[model samples]
Target: MIKREWAGETAVIIAGGPSLTVEDAVYCQGRARAVVVNDGYRIAPFADLLYAGDAAWWDGHQGAPSFAGQKWTQSKVAALRWSLRHIQSQHAYGISDSPERIHSGQNSGFQALNLTYLLGARRILLLGFDMQPTGGSRHWFGNHPPELHRDSNYAAWRGWFDIAAKQLVCRGVEVVNCSRETALTVFPRSTIQACL
Candidate 1:
């Protein structure tokens, strides 16, 4: 089970949307606790946590992510030699209130949201959660390696996020979308500087 280590603090989750920039990640350093999703660690290696769901990703990284902080995954069988915390996965939609597991929402970004909530973050900020292709690119670092799924089911993902937003509100948690450009309209928008 995860501990409420960051109780009442703000957490930032960084995704790999094309609208994301290294500057965005750099700006968040020391400002708030951060969770970098998938390859987002390349830009924000100093982030507090790294989360990925695909086992293939773990395989590609040789089961050893370069991230310095905690590395978390929903993948049941990660190809890791060292210990990696495996959080239980629930249904695909909505947020899981339980601290022991998180609803996948079929994307790392959404899962990171559930994680931050469980970690006791009262406010969560989303960066690079565009949820749609921007500037003709799916992600800031470009497409994943050939073996992994590339296309995103944006509609379904958005629906899941919408449900999660409402649930967070009911729990008195605050969520803000701080992406520079985004298709997600479920959360109130704000600039990273303003949020900090």
Candidate 2:
């Protein structure tokens, strides 16, 4: 449904990492098209799009907080096991021949990035893509409990983003990492203020 929604326009993707601050949320609200990641809705209530890859996450939220933007869940075989009720792109299966599916990143942020590209965002700015915890919170929402995700799978996650970044850049899209604290170095780092 995101056919050229922001063609040649800028889009800000808000991830749930701790680096995602209230200031960043404010900047995206009425400025640019906001594409929020799972649980990021708590911050950017008016997000233009919401993306969740893991089915368990949908179940855990129990769909408590409804979103106004189109909610997308990965259509991969494993992701459908949880449920597709009330979500878009459920029946879509297999992988696309597009570059977004090249490495088929597993994390929600990377997946959201690919979707944004498909949606026609020429310049995409990232916020809260810390890729690691800051202080005590793994996420701005405090949802990623340590007990559940012990390992954090840093290497695998980074690798996926690395591949995805290269593919997107080669395709002529500018992916800027606005979260300066992020461990991910694949994308050129920039400040949220600068991108805004």
Candidate 3:
């Protein structure tokens, strides 16, 4: 586990929101980089890092991106957990080849957000983490099929995001629900200009 230091106050966090300001973009670079979440990995060029259950980290045969990179560590009370050992076999094909960086042991959304919080960041922005699919707004799973699962598509995206947002706020790590389209109303929600 890459346990981040609590006292150092490092990095920021961005969801896959489309409206990230240039200032936030700059914050993701240089020394103390940022850690983006989920599809945040694909659209985003930088995030000090990312986290997910072992299954989400990749596809079994090809090692391309998959829903595993965006899943909760453990299935919710309503959902069921599936085997992701296939990802392990494709280890050589991912961004971080190390075994430790991929497996999600048993973290739900709370656990995943906590990984970023442990960094002791001064600021963490939950960008357009709007979990809703908004009719046709697609997700990664829709573009890439899960090799061993069923119905892991765009709609489930909302449930995972809601859990993660709630987890972040419950832990007192400021989370903003900036997506005008997704009215989850989980947190108070806010908007702030990135410091210029």
Candidate 4:
């Protein structure tokens, strides 16, 4: 579970997409709960929460930030815990994954989105969720590392994203895509200035 819930507050999910800006991060720092996903920490080093789901990332991120928020991941072992695991088999083959402690297999950013809702943020602003290649790189950090293996057709991935967005909205979480140019259009678009 998150150390504390932000029940009536807003959350900013910082994805590693190139559209993310340092100015946005700085502006949202104290104004909203910042949930940084995976290597998003490289940009928003002062994030309120850090979530890295892939086991490989955990093994390699030896010097991640020591933020006040606890690190979150999907655990293989089933137990009563705060951070939940995303059952991959359930999400494969076009199955609809729920936010009830399990996540959709879209990507780490999706997992962080689930975590933000689970932590009780009534409003969420998605940052850097470009969901496309930028300058030959999959993320703002640069090209996809040779070691990582993530392959999904654009249509299938979009379906998964749509499902997750629907669930979040149904549960009373108002989600907005703050990226000026993002492939994800499931949620209504908003500007960082307007949100601030």
Best candidate according to TM-score? 1
List clash counts for every candidate, in order. Answer: 0, 0, 10, 1
lDDT of each: 0.89, 0.72, 0.42, 0.69
Per-residue lDDT of candidate 2, residues 1-196 (tens digit): 3455678878999998887888878777777888888888878889988877766676676643577777777645324553342223322222223533422355677778777887788899999998988776678877664433545666677877776676677778898999847888888988878877
Against the true structure, whose lDDT is highest? Answer: 1
By TM-score, is 1 or 2 better? 1
In model 3, what lDDT does residue 47 have? 50
Candidates ranked by lDDT = 1, 2, 4, 3
lDDT (10s digit) by residue, model 4, range 1-196: 2322778789899888777778876778678888898887777777877876666665566535344565667644321233333333234422233344546556777777766776778899989888876555567676545565466355655667787777777778799999756888899998877986
TM-score of each: 0.96, 0.81, 0.50, 0.81
lDDT of 1: 0.89
Name the TM-score of candidate 3.
0.50
Per-residue accuracy of model 1 over 1-196 as CA lDDT, tens digit each = 8899999999999999999988888999999999999898889999999998888888887765466899889887882543678899887668998888999898889888999999999999999999999999999998988988667899889989999999999999999999999999999999888999
Model 3, 1-196: lDDT tens digits are: 3444544454445544344444544444654445555445554455545543434433332232343332233222211333322222111211222323432312222234445554455345454444545445434224334543334243444444555555555555565543434444655555534321
The candidate 3 region of ten consecutive residues with least summed lDDT is 85-94
Error of 1 at 148 (Å): 1.2
